[model samples]
Target: MNAQDVINFLQDNPSFFEDNPDVLTQITVPHHTGGQAISLTERQVSTLREKLAQVQGKLSELVGFGEENDSISAKVHHLTLSLLIAESFESVSQSLYTHLTEGFAVPHVQLRIWNSILKRPLPEFVEVSEELLFFAADLQRPLCGPVQQAEVQAWFGESAEQLRSWALIPLRRDAQVFGMLALGSEDAQRFFPEMGTLYVERIGDLVSAAVLRHIG
Candidate 1:
């Protein structure tokens, strides 16, 4: 783990090893002699160090999750501010898409509006695979994270791998799905449900409102 993560994890889990006194004794010292306790030895120190390394690895995983969550939070904040100040839908969509791709380190992204006349979702942005680019644009209902992945992969086959993980968040207004913002990363884990969705959902709500005000 990095220095900040190390400090945060240690502070948060001060009692992580409390129940396992054997592990504690391996790293701690006896307060008094012949008091039914023993001090750590050189061998114990090595073992404790090994355990520390393992714990640090877990902490690093947490650090990564924290980073993604923080990125989404920042992007949502920026979008909120922009909405309050902006005057046009095009400007808002462009800014939002750029922020989404950059903050998530995704290589491809698209924003689309649900086209009721065509009975399908139409692509507002097309990158990489064009064959299935407009698949999610026409869906009248909100597509959740899991279903969105299935639909894209089903339409594109092997080509979807080039974009890796993808998330289609429905932009809803007046209880209707008006549009969606799709974010894609080369890493499959980037859009997995295990990852935080606070930012994505918040962005979806903003996009929905914008679409309602401008397109709905």
Candidate 2:
């Protein structure tokens, strides 16, 4: 009979193995490694071993990711507590910048605010164009990847030219976006389109809330 017919017969008669147990030991299959033949039992054991190895590998990878995420979450929590304790907008900015640069190893960070009343003039109070304001408003989430807009990159000053990647987070109070936080790195892959933005978005939210408390 044809291979399919034989397979169908074997499936249809599950008791055939019980009826003739010798056939289980006598049947042979090609070894997966390609050098020799193996009995059905040996082949089955080999297949199971390969599957187990794959499952163990995946489990290890998952565990590594879990540990990394836990570390990041702890850092975020610490930063959040620091920001909440900051007495003024300047202190909040300082804390945010310091933690990001020292704790997170971010090379460059820039904060800019527009259309807000500042009690004292700060570098972050620099004028932003209508185009940039519109861009900030349009962002529903943090933008991460290679810096594409020259004006946006210019916000980082002299290092702008060498910055290889960026994460742009729009800072908003209620529904109105009034500021932006730019993070840059020399490594091109530091921020990429495929990377998750959950932590960055939460940072933006925290910064926005803290800054809004000071702005008129």
Candidate 3:
């Protein structure tokens, strides 16, 4: 009979192995590793071992990812505590910059707030164009990738050209976006379109809350 017929027969008769147990031991298959023939039992064992190795490798990778996530969570917690202690707008900005630069090793950061009423004028409260304000308003989440806007890149001053990648997060209070936070790095892969923005979104939420508290 043909291979499919034999397979159909084997599947149809589940008791075929039980009826002739010796056939299982007698059947030989090519060894997966190299130039040798092995019994069907040995080939099955080898396949199982290979699968087990793959599973182990995947488990180890998952554990490593978990550890990395835990470390980042701890850093976020520390930054939140620092923000909590900040008493003024300047202190809040300083805390954000210091934590992001020193704790997270970010190369450059810039913040610009639009349409905010402040008791004292701050550099962050600088005027922004209507286009930028619209762009910020349209963002549903943090934007990550190469800096596409020249005006936004200029906020980094002399380091603007060297900064190859950026992450822009809109600072929102209620339904209005009052500001934007931009982070930059020399490494092109530091920010990418496909990268996850969970932590960055959280940072944005924290910064928006702190900034809103000081706004008049």
Best candidate according to TM-score: 2
Task: Report the C-alpha lDDT of model 3 over 99-194, residue by residue, as the tens digit.
Answer: 999998998999888778774576787787898989999999999999689889889999998988999999998879989999999999999999
Give each model a TM-score. Answer: 0.54, 0.92, 0.89
lDDT string, candidate 2, 28-52, tens digits: 9999889879899899999999999
Which candidate do you rate higher for lDDT, 2 or 3? 3
Which residues of candidate 2, in runs, are more than 4 Å off? none
Which candidate tops lDDT? Answer: 3
lDDT of each residue in 1-216, candidate 1, tens digit only:
799997898699888667566765566455333344455654466568889999999999999988967866786787677765656667667677666657546566666654433322334532324333355445543343344355555444465667657677767655555555666666766677566566667777777776556554
Each prediction's whole-model lDDT (CA): 0.61, 0.90, 0.91
Clashing pairs in 3: none
Return the candidate ranking by TM-score, descending: 2, 3, 1
Whole-structure CA lDDT of model 1: 0.61
